[model samples]
Target: MNPSEDQIYVIIFSTLFLGGLMSTFVVAMVFIHRQRQAQNKQKLDQIKSEHEKTLLNIENEIQQDTLTHVGRELHDNIGQLLSLAKLYLGSSKPEKQQEGKETINQVISEVRALSKNLNLDWVESLTIEEFIEQQLQKIESTGFCKTTFEHSIELGELPKDQKLVLIRVIQEILNNAMKHASPEEIKVKIWKDGATRTIQIKDNGKGFDTSIESSGSGMYNLKKRMETIGGDVSITSSIGNGTLIHLLLPN
Candidate 1:
């Protein structure tokens, strides 16, 4: 070939090679930019979620503090003043004042109970029946479903950790029933079989097949929690039949 043709071939090859290199570099740059943007977006979302959780926790703490203060005020100050009034009012007679005093006593009892229930940490002060009643009372107060509690299990020396976990498990179960099962009535029955304490919760709702997969993580988490607490959960349900959840606590 002539020198001119050889030079032309070399220039064409160089130009094509240079173009390919530039195209590759541009594509790589775009990919890196997208990767960095994705990473930054993930970080921002994580930060925002953490911030919201922190705020929620702080709000809960403040509410707990307010409940504690109110409970103390009711039991100490209002209860004392009621007693003083009972004495003054009874200074005249018994029949007329007894009714008033007894009413005041009932109020005091309710206030104390309310105070105890306002904070879950103080649930240790209640018996198993009382704790269950408190939870049911909360549910009933919501007016979502009619709840009936039958507790035959006597209160013994139960561990505080177990008490707390049991409360959480009960709450979770009730939450599942309310959210997923759409129950009109929920019945909670507690009984003891020697060393085994049982909590049975039955709901008249559209039960799902337990053998099949479910989108609800609440049931899975409930079972996980019971296992974590050295307890076991037995759930029975069909498509149309109502659901029954039993928790056996080996204490």
Candidate 2:
């Protein structure tokens, strides 16, 4: 009853073929699993990037909105009070100038109030162009650095958040120029090119090497702020050539 040679050969061939097919199936499964893992990682990375961008945008929106409210309060409330004080001073009788010294006292109080709210409210309410002009006027009043501001666009309609961010960025840049650039003249230009708004600040001062490490928290914060709003900042300067700060934001 022993099996013939042909039957034994057939049985062996069948076993070998099945074994090879099982091995191929296992290898194919491993390859598919690896591919799936790679795809999942890529998707996770994309989601993380998108989430970061969304968070930054939200931060910018909140900051701008808060500044706008503060700006309005300064212009409508404090600014009016100052104007009223000036009017009272103008109408005071000459005979009672000494006795009407209360008018002067009131004016001084108004001035102090205005100064207290200048940076917070006045800046928040002004359009980008108006804010820049006011900043230049302030710098000129100091008589330390001559400032020039140029604008090509009517920026009355710019988003409040964007205006606030731009104002802060420019303020930081100008402060750096005045403190470090030692420049006699500082020029700031704001304009729109197609769909993009640009701000350029240049100073004819003693420049520094950009390659060296800088301990400027203002500049770093400005960069972070701009990034939150999907804006960009660039600096160009050398040991004696002067310094230039450029900011670009989408309209």
Candidate 3:
């Protein structure tokens, strides 16, 4: 028997209603997905902004420190050399004149070396190894402590931002050791294994317990800074055994 008109109308109406519900569900899903994508993008942009700001602040601090160092060298070292050269040149002897000429040449060389540090562009061309050696030499020259550096392995090239961050971090650690630890000797070592690079700075000075958060090593701030560069900072110390800090980085 054939279907009646009333039955056919009911069947068509039911089909239309189900199709409408499906379309509404799809639209809702699309709307929710787009909203989530927007939120994620905003979060990412904020994080990028914060990272850049931190990097800029660090660069400024490094520049300021460099300027301070240059000022001290000019006053304490170069000034003395110039005074001696003037004295020698004023003497009435040929030997004295020759000595003055040599001293003036030395002064010129020293000035040239200092001029390089006045700008941060030199940092781009310097490797981590070279920077460490320079810092150690400076520390030793101050007569505050003896310093040594050992490079057991070479690290691959690093991004410029990462390199700058590392330099600042190392400088902070050394400064802290000298100011707080009062160590007679400071040592820095670098090594690498597979994809991991490590820098270890050790001081044979009074140490603090790592368990305490207020140990004054500024480890908390250092750790946070390392996180910004995808690195890790760890410390080992006791009350009198001295302090050892390890900085870890990925290839």
Best candidate, TM-score-wise?
Answer: 3
Report the C-alpha displacement of residue 38, candidate 1, in angstroms: 44
Stretches of candidate 1 above 4 Å error? 1-120
Model 2: per-residue Cα lDDT at residue 123: 52
lDDT-superior candidate, 2 or 3? 3
**C-alpha lDDT score of every prediction, in listed order:** 0.78, 0.74, 0.89
Tell me how far the alpha carbon of residue 52 in candidate 1 is from the true structure, in angstroms, after superposition. Answer: 24
Q: Please write out the lDDT profile of model 2 over residues 120-170, one tens digit for every residue.
A: 455556677777787789788999788888888776666655656676677
Q: Model 3: C-alpha RMSD to truth?
A: 4.0
Clash list (residue pairs), candidate 3: none
Sliding window of 10 residues with minimal summed lDDT for model 1: 53-62
**Candidates sorted on lDDT, descending:** 3, 1, 2
User: TM-score, each model?
Assistant: 0.52, 0.59, 0.80
- For candidate 3, lDDT tens digit of each residue in 1-251? 35787788888988998899899999999999999999999998987887798799889999999899899999999999999999999999999999999999999999999999888887788889999999999899999999999999876577888888899999999988888789999999999877788999999999988888875547887887788888999999998989999999855
> Over the stretch 130-236, how does candidate 1's per-residue lDDT look in tens digits?
86788788789999889999877675767765666676678668878888888889999989887888999999989998888677666786776666557899999
Clashes of 2: 0
